[model samples]
Target: MNDMTPRSFDGREYPYTPQDFAAVSAMVHAHSGICLPQTKTMLVYSRLAKLVRERGLRDFASYIDLIRRDPAERQRAIEAMTTNHTKFFREDHHFRQFERDVRPGLIERLDAGGKVRMWCAAASTGEEPYSLAMSLLGPDPVEGRVIAGADVAILGTDLSGAVLDVARRGHYPAALSQDVPLDLRQTWTRVSGGTMAVAPMLRDLVRYRRLNLLNAWPMRGRFDVIFCRNVMIYFDEPTRERLVQRLVDQLAPGGHLYIGHSERIGGEAARRLRAIGQTVYRKDAA
Candidate 1:
């Protein structure tokens, strides 16, 4: 890993070395708690090289230097390196589990004049929270809080402002809406300019905010259902474990917690949470 290393990627010249990637890995992990493995050198370069060039820097080393000198520039690098891969009902089974067990149980509680809250902790582009909205309340006004006789709200938060902006817009490419069920689509979205716009009712049910899970959480209430999927894969064991425990702290008694299909709760979090389905756990009523 010399300073002069040069590699061509995606038809562009990148003067990044192994050292540069390692520095990036350390920086992002510290900033966002996302561990970028060494294997993603090419992917990292491909995603960040443009930002380097945009900053009038010649290479990764230059960008790293800027981050070292100017803390503000580090946020740009964090934004560039963070991955936000998500889609509506990306894991259909989780939603199905929601409909089968979580929904019925939660609605029963709602019927008993209880307030139920849901958090899509990694709500990328609004799909997941909107899906929850469609589930808890329906696609229109008729089935909302006015008629449901319960307090229901969805808080959708993400670390990326870029994606949060998109989430607030309630619009998406038509292809991204393919997984949406036909009935739900007709009820919740209207097609325009080859994109689907979420119904106002559905939008009304969700609040989008920019939040870093590694930082302080401003949310003050307990949630009955929490969806924080496909995010912990990037965090190391310690960070993941701590995050799981924090999530557990945000849940009401017997509240459900869902993680990515590949993630598992360990240590005390595991002892406190009861596994209910594939990648789904519920806080024990202890």
Candidate 2:
């Protein structure tokens, strides 16, 4: 925006004008619901600059024109710009709450010939859903018991197909496994070549699918608990509220919804849910 701000990058002087930045930001928000503030000018430049080069474009203005013309390229641009940082058992306190208060009730349903349904709304690279799988169906691999073999299912979805590719592979660097408890880690991960592969049992418990939070969801029925965490921080309030309401509709009565620790719901969406814990809310059973 100004001389001090990063208008240029690498070795080249940034040729795009402020109007160019604004247009790109507006297009991204309209397509993905992620609000890129003017402060993120550098971020936008950093993420898309390579694409400009790859496209053989001379400047950001030309790059924007190409994205306008090509739907596939636009999708690729969205993938390139998205921020995907997640870990196993991230927001540990929420997992603690689930293991204690939530699991017991869901166990009751399992005992009644029902299945425990959990959805990781943004299953970045597979960690969150796998951690949830371990928590839902215990660490041990007993095939027909209270948990280790209980009737449970998890659905993991994210807007980014590239990250979803990583998710389906079910592997992560060993260092990233630290957030997982020792027993669960040992039970669920097979270590080799310095990366941990999630055990078949755990992987089998969850299904990974590509989902755009701002687009139509093909899912049916409701979930006992839904984790739609830090993904909303990039969205403006109106977009956030709309997404929250849709998530609420997919939640079973009295089911829990987990958002990012720093994210919140407002207006009618806020009224339908009551705070149960940090960034966790319970839908009114009525």
Candidate 3:
């Protein structure tokens, strides 16, 4: 069979045609702003095959029809299509830059009885936001408490409700904690058996919400630091440009924006943001 042909050797499963792939791809883009290329045909098939079987549907066509009519199933399909590959301190230098530059001003604001905010736009399973929390708070103890009191909030938002549940729990396999810095890991995380849990201090500073980037955002205030890394790669040029503009609009003056290393600022966002470090941009202070 060709690339477009379904891999049903025994004819026991549904035949996934090129048309089905195209339909699923378009539906994903329409609902989530994610661009699924032909290269992802097998990925789409593998991810949705279980759903089709669970629904007792023997064909991809019926599964597609059901999703088009059922909002809950549509959400599930989108969530399944989403790629949530993240780990603590995945980009170590970003966190280092954040601590060396971004945290000082935020700490100053907090000291002066001002509120500071951070947003992890693609906070898959909560590692990115939790990393931000650890970077902001550091290893120092305050008044015998490991968590230093501060007027700060880190908002972690993603389109996957299922991942949001994991983010809220702040638990992971113990092996995943390896990427975290030694001091930060010891201070901000707890390890028991094969499981690692983000310390209550880190959890206290972060909150998770299910938010579709293509949909309307209800947030009111600007963020001092926004981490929308590794997400724009899934979007087309127009979608990416619009999303960056929106991110800039929600960014506070003098705030920092960190994106995927492979992604670049374009169009209006290029003029609005200044590149300082690798994949990091800063908005001018008012």
Give the top-scoring candidate (TM-score).
Answer: 3
- Which candidate model has the greater TM-score, 2 or 3? 3
- What are the lDDT figures for the candidates, one per model? 0.83, 0.85, 0.89
Residue 20 CA displacement from its true place in model 2, Å: 1.7
For candidate 2, the 10 contiguous residues with the lowest summed lDDT are 1-10
Candidate 1 Cα deviation (angstroms), residue 263: 1.2
lDDT (Cα, 0-100) at 92 in candidate 2: 91
**Count: clashes, candidate 2:** 0
Q: Encode model 3's per-residue lDDT on 165-242: one tens digit a residue.
A: 999999999998888899888888889999999888778788888999989999999999999999999999999999
- Runs of candidate 2 exceeding 4 Å displacement: 1-14, 143-151
TM-score of each: 0.90, 0.92, 0.94
Candidate closest to the true structure, highest lDDT: 3
Clash totals in order = 0, 0, 0
The RMSD of every model to the true structure, in order and in angstroms, is 3.7, 4.1, 3.6
